[model samples]
Target: MERIQEALAKARAQRQQGSATRTEHAAPPKINPSVDDAWGALSPFKLNRALLKSHRVVAAETGRDAAPYDLLRTKIIHQAQMNNWRRVAIVSPDMGAGKSTTVANLAFSFERQRDMRVLCIDLDLRRPSLHKVLGQKSDHSMSDVLNGHVRFSEHGLRLGERVAFGLNNGPAPNPSELLLSQAARDTLEGIEQDYAPNLTLFDISPLNASDDNIAFLQNVDCAIIIAAAETTPIKRIDQAERQVAELTNVMGIVLNKCRYISDNDGYDYY
Candidate 1:
């Protein structure tokens, strides 16, 4: 914790010492919408080294294959900065479309930004995998927070002080109902108010799989739709876009899992 604090302090100092023009893209003043006492209690825990490797997520480092994530991250950040969008949801047209993987990788990619703070909340209740993807394990989950059993910030896994996560744990029989409830909205708002992250990402269930994704989308500022190459149906993608467009801005689409044979330079996202 001490080390992380020092690193953050040093980074901030460097940011402050930069040329005067650096503040040109400064974030908008806060409205302080969700501030609460729970914000101060979030714990810091180290991610599992082996687990990160298995998921191909390295928070601070950008490898060749992760290049696409870096590109996506830059574009999203530019848009978020321009629009003052703090919360963004990642969803796909259907299951097995690699939305979870895209969300996880994007979170890590955003975490790499020295001046940015990111929070990733896994809302894919029926098939929660963000915690596993981040190689995190905990007694507290989003369910506990929603059930009023725990504070929203109490059990987060940290990637330095800048990156934190509130992951879903067990399947909920009534996932859509839970997401639409005021309790769920309050929990997410509480986390945002507390952490004051530059970006908040919700890893949601596939659009056609259940009502969960659509319900969750209502709370976020914008969304990204990830489509699997050759695997996802065009009709479903169109339907998902129509649904999300009515709720929030469709930031852009990410095409994943296309056949990429290794070449002289590196692998391509295509």
Candidate 2:
């Protein structure tokens, strides 16, 4: 813990010293109605319970399977509220670490909060899969919105009144360049300005995969690294942690797909 803290402090110091002035842009075009009104206007979609269950998006269930995600939601909300962070990136050291699963569950968990408005954007352009995990398809992908081919209002889908998703239909070409472009920044800023979600979760590519995650990390206020318990190495986690801390605040690490459960951990009642 101490080592992690030290690394975070060092990285933050470096970030502060090297931070560059942000490019100024003209005021973004606003939606006709207010932010809340625009959010309410999003197209609603019905979720398939069985499909969600098969994908292990247990946070939508009423059973004990949802408990862990609820706890994660509480912790994330607390930390984000404390720090005034709205945009959060969910990243991993490599592919197949359940980062997309975590993003889905976490978004559903936030849905349980009546007052919370959440936006989940699938930014994993090279291998987009969040839509499949959620069992939904979109006519316009996030890439289209980022490239100004489609407006977010036209592309985003609403799940209930509280959650909205910016999904991808297929793999996008030249993902890194797209993510780092000024158009990307402008589009993201416009979404935040118009949607005004309490939390905007971006499911990005793995840290070790390419420069895509690095390019997009600059737009987020903080990030959470997801690691597969037995598959993700400690060194990779450390390296990813250091890299994220250098770019933005490190909320914490989440360990997924663990098989062992201690008897004394106190969930037997469930």
Candidate 3:
């Protein structure tokens, strides 16, 4: 527990530094009134409430199960809006840490905000579980879109007027190389320019899995590391936090799947 607290403190210090740097050089964002129109053009799909609940995406629910994620959504939005951060990557120390579920719930939570536009992308090309979690199978591969072979509009899907998703059906070949390439950066830039989402959440590979997350972290403005309680080791969380802080702003660490929270402790649920 001491190690975890240390990691959190380091992350907070890194976030403060990143915020200062961005504030020093950040320019005012351009107002794009057509952003809503762009989002509206995407094909809309209905969310399966039952399927989402089964997959642990309960942020859309009005119950206590949704409280933690709603608070997470609020914190993320506050930090992003304050620091002019638009791209955020969600990663974990290792697989099975609930990274994908967190991304989906955040998307749903962001969707409830009528004025916020969100783009959820599955950048975990090695496994790509986000699509399954969202209960939507994509006909298009996100890797193809990143490689410039397909346009985002052709490969993306929308929910209502605010949320868009870029999902993948299968794993990509040489995902690390692809993420490190110039094409991937260009593709992301184009997407942000065209879609104009208030926030873009990337469900990327775990930190200890491979170089894929490290390669792709350069493209995002900030990241949050999700660690599973009673499962993820404190040393792993510390290492992952350090790696992310070196690459981008460390927003904070999320302790997921906790089973032992006191009745009075609501803020530490996630």
Candidate 4:
């Protein structure tokens, strides 16, 4: 115990000295930048590394032709190019299916892998959770934009070096009614214009034939439906695919929260 105490004291003294030296040499602190501003200002190098690891894990489990995120990124960009689509919507069969998680990761992957300016707009409205998933505040949401209460440039939430996201905590009056408003159209248009050649992902509600997903689909370039493992039935997946088909171009389906084993038979993913 005496030896341990001495070692601890020495370590603490060294740390304090180092910290003092650093502080003395450190430059003055800069202004606290807004979320979107910070995102746009920072480069995507560091975030890309984290995304690469995620892709490797996913690819390993799916047995897909390409690397995990690389495969998805390539597919998404290809779809965008083929259809001249800039907006992508990530939806699910229902709530609690990891759609927001997938959207956040996908946005990160796109920015990291494709080197494109990516923005994810959470239009879930009724049940907004993208902020929680991304560890961001939900005070400012897409609801503000849809209601013409806030400007897009002001409310966009930055997620990383170059990724920004927006949230909507259900628009005024009724979300369904707001979905059809001209303000919604203008907001989408503004985003497309400002983030030119950028990829935008809309995290929207489930499609139950005549739900908001149908209307939301009209604004995006393509849509990806998320289905939870075991929780989502093939019938619903089929229905989702079919419903998205009613639109011009549909991206595909994401099997969310999948479990996988490594080639060495080790478990992963916490």
Write model 2 residue lDDT over 113-192, tens digit each, in one string: 88777889999999999999999988878999999999999988898878899999999989988987889988888787
Give residue 32's lDDT in candidate 3 (0 to 100).
70
TM-score for candidate 4, residues paired by index: 0.70
Q: In what order do the candidates fall by lDDT, top score first? A: 2, 3, 1, 4
- Count clashing residue pairs per candidate: 0, 0, 0, 2
Residues 107-218 of candidate 3 have per-residue lDDT tens digits of: 8888788777788999999999998998887778899999888999888899777789999999999998898787887788778878877788999998777778767775
Global lDDT for candidate 2?
0.82
Task: Give the whole-model CA lDDT for all candidates, comma-separated.
Answer: 0.72, 0.82, 0.82, 0.62
C-alpha-based local distance difference test score of model 4: 0.62
Instruction: Report each candidate's C-alpha RMSD, comma-separated, in the order given.
Output: 12.2, 5.7, 5.8, 20.5
Instruction: Give a tens-digit lDDT track for model 1, residues 1-270.
Output: 454334334434543453232232234424343432333356765656677767756433567767778888999989988877777889988888877777777777876787777878888989888777766677867877776788765677676546678886667668777877878867765666566677888889887676676566656777999998998888878877887776667898887888676687667654
Off by over 4 Å in 1: 1-41, 58-60, 260-267
Error of 2 at 143 (Å): 0.5
Query: Which segments of model 4 are wrong by more than 4 Å?
Result: 1-67, 169-173, 262-270
lDDT of 4 at 41: 51
- Superposed by TM-score, candidate 2 places the C-alpha of residue 163 at a distance from the truth, in angstroms, of 0.8
Quote model 1's TM-score: 0.80
